[model samples]
Target: MKKIRYVFYMPVWRKGQWKDNFIGYGIAIWTFALNCWKPKMWKYIRKHFFSHVEMWFPDEDGKFITMTPEIDLEPFAINSVPQFTGQCFSSTMRDAQGVRFALASEVLRNPRRWWYIEATVTDTRYELMLLLAKRQEGKPYDKWGLFTGFFMLAPYLQNDDERYCSDVCAWLAWMANILPKRLWIISPRRFAWLLVKNLNRELKPLVKGKYNGKIQKHSRISRCVQIR
Candidate 1:
């Protein structure tokens, strides 16, 4: 059996149109900088975007994070796409179709900054993703998917704006809450579309730049997808 694990990170993507075609870099930049202060940064971020955050803590890896109780909602985009089978995500509901999921310890967002989830994962896809991020080996970004059973959060829609979070980031976060220890099954296709939706024009400006690249790659989802 072929085994491959994928890792992903954000604000990471293919080169876009402008020399600096960030959807909203200044905002995310400010937030990343402010995150240095923790309490004040958390307070300021919650004021505008989050409806309510559920958890916040520091991990063994020195990653301090806050968790938000994910709102129970399905993704709205796939509603109209018939090609997508019955589910908010085609990869999730189908059996034998391998989808990747990361265990989330927190939900952090800033209007002009970022929306992130930190988790542990195993049995993932898209090896190319990590090779590109240049993260440390054995770090969260270091492994790919497998039957070995590990989990971690990859990239997510950085925009948790009040109007969009429900459809964009909350469902995945909710999924993480439900299956905190199991492989959540990340789908490259699903996340690729996520990037498309977040970066496209006509959508309200959530951040500053277009995030690019594969969220995760599918090797042979046949083994994982169930015939439902």
Candidate 2:
């Protein structure tokens, strides 16, 4: 059996330590339970441990860049793409166009808010994944689909038109041929569980630290930590 190797980093909030342990294409999981405002639907009701997930890759200059679909109300542009307004929420539903980019350093400013998981990918696949992710630079966030699909109310609502955090990551993996086929709709916690279950290996810290991170050995899911 091929073992998938991964390094789990503790929530130390040290930029220098994170910089020294950078992986060109690494996946980061954000635990919303850490937030002061709780996501009642995702956490308490649905029982999901993770709130969001994002992937990062190094640019030509070797600077890491993070990509994630979020509910941004700001106007932004990427490359030759015309400037576009981001997602907006009204009395009813949310508007489209929520893809956002940021320097890895900026996103990792509060390492305590996220759990870093570095997976091994081949050079060719890494390049392909980066290319595929860039193509979604201006995609919209699937606000409605997130809830509907999760509850199995409208599975057909799952499309490429818009994507949530985990949807984007799953789409990229499918597009890059890492996954056999697209996972239409998946929660961030469910996705992380799948990865950990399929990839047989012991979890260890990426950097030496006095603080230790723990993951449930039976379920392979990390306990959510409250930030405040």
Candidate 3:
């Protein structure tokens, strides 16, 4: 299957108001799932942002090099309503007055920033992606990354925000050698159990049932621990 990309930009409303675009929730979700799935999530993100952004390199010898391409955006359409919903009619406000939503061209430049953010989140800091996504569902990568990239770039908080997220965060804090308590690991084993559950969807269930319940079973048949 050829690799594809999708990006969904979900908006956040805090206290019933628009917050940061979709990056807020999308970041957290991607990161959490990646950390849960693979412990080396951060390493992957670090390589992408600081290192040269990669594109397919061509050589008869099968060597690949990275390249940067000029990707532009469609001009912002003014006097236009939101694509999916016209909710902006009421929320669109201007300085000293309530006006329609007509964003300037400079404001549209966030797309490039989004590209960097998405790439960074997916590269190594997948957990941060997950955390960001927890706030809203209509995120950028959630749609764009899915519709275009065909990857789960858009964060899905509902899917990964529960106990498993705590597990991923806790593990990240632990790896950083930060106190686990600050990361809320009073129930490390509890979060671990949830991690195993979410992981079951990706891989196979490392241990069945609840955390404590599966402890003995895991100990007895412990051979290849996938979520360790």
Q: Which candidate is the best by TM-score?
A: 2
TM-score of predicted structure 1: 0.20
TM-score of each: 0.20, 0.52, 0.19
Candidate order by decreasing TM-score:
2, 1, 3
Better of 1 and 3 by TM-score: 1
Q: Give candidate 2 regions above 4 Å deviation.
A: 1-48, 59-97, 150-153, 202-228
Candidate achieving the largest lDDT: 2
Residue pairs in clash, model 2: 97-140
Writing each residue's lDDT as its tens digit, candidate 3 over 1-228 gives: 111111112223345433342334444344444444444444433322210111111123321111223223566333211111111111111221221222212122122211111011122333343333334222221122212212443333222223222233334434432323433321222233333343332212212332322222112221222121
TM-score attained by model 3: 0.19
Q: Please give the distance, in angstroms, between residue 36's alpha carbon in candidate 3 and its true position after superposition.
A: 7.4
Candidate 2 versus truth, CA RMSD in Å, comes to: 15.7
